[model samples]
Target: MASALPNSLFQQYFNNNDYADIIVELKHPVQDTNCPKSTEYFPMHQIIACSTSTYFKEACFNAETNPIGTKLLFFDISLEAFTIIAAWVYGFRGSSFERLFTEKSIRGVMDFFIDHDLETDIYPEMQELRTLLLKNLFKITTEAEVASATGSPRMDLRSLEDICEYCLPGDRNTIRRLVKQQIPQIKCSAGWLEALAGKSAAGFLASILLEIYQEAQIQ
Candidate 1:
């Protein structure tokens, strides 16, 4: 048995020109003029990038069409989502992934990976982003909680209940706790019923039901 090497060893090679044999450039449709320099370029290992993503596999290994030294530019992907992806490929499980996977970037990450050929359906690791998105959705740190009680919902929370089927031990409990914090607000929302009505929202609905059942039993 061997103790695993620290993530720093691999992360040192992240975006490092010294070790990088490949480059990645991600482009979103719109970027803030205020923060232009942050999302410029990414230096990556050819083998690591190609192994993790099929898109990179084609770009790096398809010498006939794309070649080895070609710029790997991805369109319609935000820097936040790209950071999550890049961090994952670099074997980063610390602050980088946690800090970037927020409410703002959750939608962008989910939509882009789901649409693009991330092959999340085939690989369980890629689905962590989906789980992060689900967990963030339950983090209702908005005025909606109080507003909904008074009939003026500030949050337009819709289509957020499609929970992913994958779990990593305490993932469900974490999501359950967050949802419990916002359950009052969610119940007040007019669209919660509509959103949770379909088969896709079964897991989300179950979480809510369990919460209610527990509260009732306690009372």
Candidate 2:
């Protein structure tokens, strides 16, 4: 269980942005042809970020650690994702996926969370982000859209498995669409079929397969 801080304190921290004690700097690696590296800075309260995120807590203010400077540099993550994470740390709602987040970008953030051993108890917002990402991925329509959303040719098998495991029970229609998109791969992959058969909600999987069979018969 997590302890709750007073709402007034969160509001106070948010209202006074100038009182930020830490700076999170995001940088892109140098590209070709003499184009300068891109960098963006986010000023944040150490207490808020550290309290909500294991990564920030360890990087910025682990009590027994040697001094890491005030400004922390991250090369792999995008400025937009970091900005939304920083806001969530301060008790503000994270931004919508349509505006800033993508499957690839959120995966980077998820890796950061995992590498730092971020606890869901400490950061409920991480759970929120995960759910949102799953929903958005299931909603995607095309191969090009998948490439654009995730920077991958297709949704990877692990991600598809996760969607089946977590999201299938809630919204079958969306899950059906997602599965339909991958039918070509699923038809050829014994591992995928076996994995779906092993799910707790095997009935749902059976229903989807039946629907596919019926559609094929009609065609």
Candidate 3:
């Protein structure tokens, strides 16, 4: 999912009550203004809206994109986008990126995940994360070759927007929501992010999500 509003921009407005009001208004803008048919800024607005939806995914985007509704769901959840959003929301709890990028705290979060192993635990935000990851993947992968190459653990995320621009338009929304959902769960844990930076994280998350769904089914 493309975020029309960047975290940096949102950060500037965070302290201003009026700006917060503007953001709140932006979230629930007038019906006509909500997802306009076509406009120069519609794409940008759509992306920003999708990004912010992480915080209010239930109120707005739930009906549009369901993670369990799609195949290859977790593959599409963009960890980078989620990372950016998470940092914005929880960065205050840590030191600077350089200062906080320590082995101990990172390991702490990873250990939390290893010991906790979500298994059947389904989070309210999983769908949102799937949406975001797909958006990032689409944005980064250009050709079939690039797409295939992305399966490698060493793939770069910065190329996401490029892949996104090339993918079919219809697939974008689904990708956005998946990623948005996962940001909150993963963000607070520095170790989670660090561990997920490698190749196996996507498959790990996918397996975890499937387990969650399976447990839900039995329940």
TM-score of each: 0.61, 0.51, 0.22
List the candidate numbers ranked by TM-score, top first: 1, 2, 3
Better of 1 and 3 by TM-score: 1
lDDT tens digits, residue span 95-197, model 3? 3322333223333223322333311224323333333334434333333334476442222333332233222334444533443442212122334434433
Residues 1-219 of candidate 1 have per-residue lDDT tens digits of 111555567678776777576666666654566654444576777666666555556656643324655445544677776777777766777666577666567666766765765534554456654565566645533443445556633233333343333223346566556555555444433244444545452545555545655565577
Which of the numbered candidates is closest to the native, going by highest TM-score? 1
lDDT of 2 at 176: 72
lDDT of 3 at 72: 13
Off by over 4 Å in 1: 1-5, 31-40, 50-73, 117-121, 140-177, 181-219
Candidate 3 similarity to native, TM-score: 0.22
